[model samples]
Target: MLVVIGRIGRAHGIRGELAVDLRTDEPERRFAPGSSVVCAGRSLTVKAARPHSGKLLVTFDQVADRTAAEHLRGQVIEADVDPAELPEDDDAFYDHQLIGLRVARRDGAHVGEVTGVLHLPAHDTLAIDAEGREILVPFVAALVPEVDIERRVLVVADVPGLLDPDAAETVTPPEGR
Candidate 1:
């Protein structure tokens, strides 16, 4: 299985270091020294990585100069991982694990299905297909209380306007107009 770990930004310096926008939470493992990742159909080995101005500065053994790093700009870095490998944190879940899971409310009423997971800068969002509409829900404990993988269901809070904005309660207009 291949997972997107980061995206290559502009070349940082003349030494072939490039700024990377992280897509995965496990940056220490993904961009660690000696780690190998695929980019633009080429396998590259990480020589070093460090946090720089909210982005990661990474040097690849394959990229020897600024021109080589420039060639990789805007390319996505993907890591080949084991299908059975799981995150160390029990609360963490891979995108594949959450996708296709049935979404339900706190009352166990069927709501929709998780179609995708968006890895935003702040957090991950669950893209749900409900009644032909796409609803984005923040993957948080307050909103999504339970995730029963055994049952293949994700229990979301029964908050109005969450599942359906039009269904939310609204006050009626006064009798004047």
Candidate 2:
């Protein structure tokens, strides 16, 4: 499956190289030379790639000079990744694997489908398409009890005020009544 590895940032120097913000943990190895990648719906052959600080410097065979590289900025770079290479430890689920799974409460109440997974700096949140509304639930052990990938279902313990927007907010008393 096509997994997003990085996004092309700005053109680097006068060369055909482009700055890339790597999304994958193994960017140094994934974006190396001779690796093939897809960007903006077009397949590109990697000529050279090296890590620069927190980002990656990449040169594609299709890109030549700053002008060509500029066009690719903001485009996401995707590559065919082996599912087996992904982490399989407990409590860790790949975002792609979580998609389309049915979400239910521990009491067996159907909530919705797993539509998306948001990776925040603080924590990862599961986006459940509950009926018409999207419910953002934290992927914590206390909240998410089980993730059965083979069954395509995730069992979560219903936390009070988790899905209700009104319940999430608190009213402040008037200062001068």
Candidate 3:
């Protein structure tokens, strides 16, 4: 399946190079020269790449000038990557993989189930289905310690203020169980 790798930014120079807002953490592997990428359902080849400031500057073989690069602005870059080739690390995960996983606290209290993953610049957020209420949990190390995908559970570290602080103080279990 194709995964979003980055988004085309503005044209960087008079050349075909365009600024890109990278989505993947491992750009060196995803956007390297000669890599094939898909954008707007069209295949494109990476001719060159360079780091500019905090963003990436890339040139595609089909794009010959600033005018060509201008047309690519805001287009999302995607790649058909094999999931197994992804970095062997616990922290790395695809957005779709986290969906529907049960979300619980370290104390074994059930909080909710992961419904979706929100991608933000600073960090990713987990959308939890909590008692019919949506709870957004920041997918960070300190708050989210473990992701047991095999058993389909996410272990969240105990942090009093991370959830609804005021409600947590007065929370009472529902009468059913």
lDDT of 2 by residue, 98-177 (tens): 99999988877898999998754445789999998999999888888899988999998766678667665577999996
Write down the TM-score of every candidate.
Answer: 0.78, 0.71, 0.75
lDDT of 1 by residue, 35-61 (tens): 999999989999999999999999999
Superposition TM-score, candidate 2 onto the true structure:
0.71
Clash pairs detected, candidate 2: none
Per-residue lDDT for 1-177 in model 3, tens only? Answer: 677778888998899898988878789888889999998779999999989999999998888999988988888888887865654455787776788999888988998899997765566799999889888889998889999888999988767756565545556899998
Off by over 4 Å in 2: 82-95, 104-109, 117-126, 136-151, 155-162, 171-177
Clashing pairs in 3: none
How far residue 125's Cα lies from its native spot in candidate 3, in Å, is: 2.2
Candidate 1 — which residues are off by over 4 angstroms? 67-75, 168-177
C-alpha RMSD values across all candidates: 4.0, 4.0, 7.4
Q: Which of the two candidates, 1 or 2, achieves a greater lDDT against the reference? A: 1
What stretches of model 3 exceed 4 Å from their correct place? 67-75, 83-86, 158-162, 165-177
How many pairs collide in each candidate, listed in order? 0, 0, 0
Best by TM-score: 1
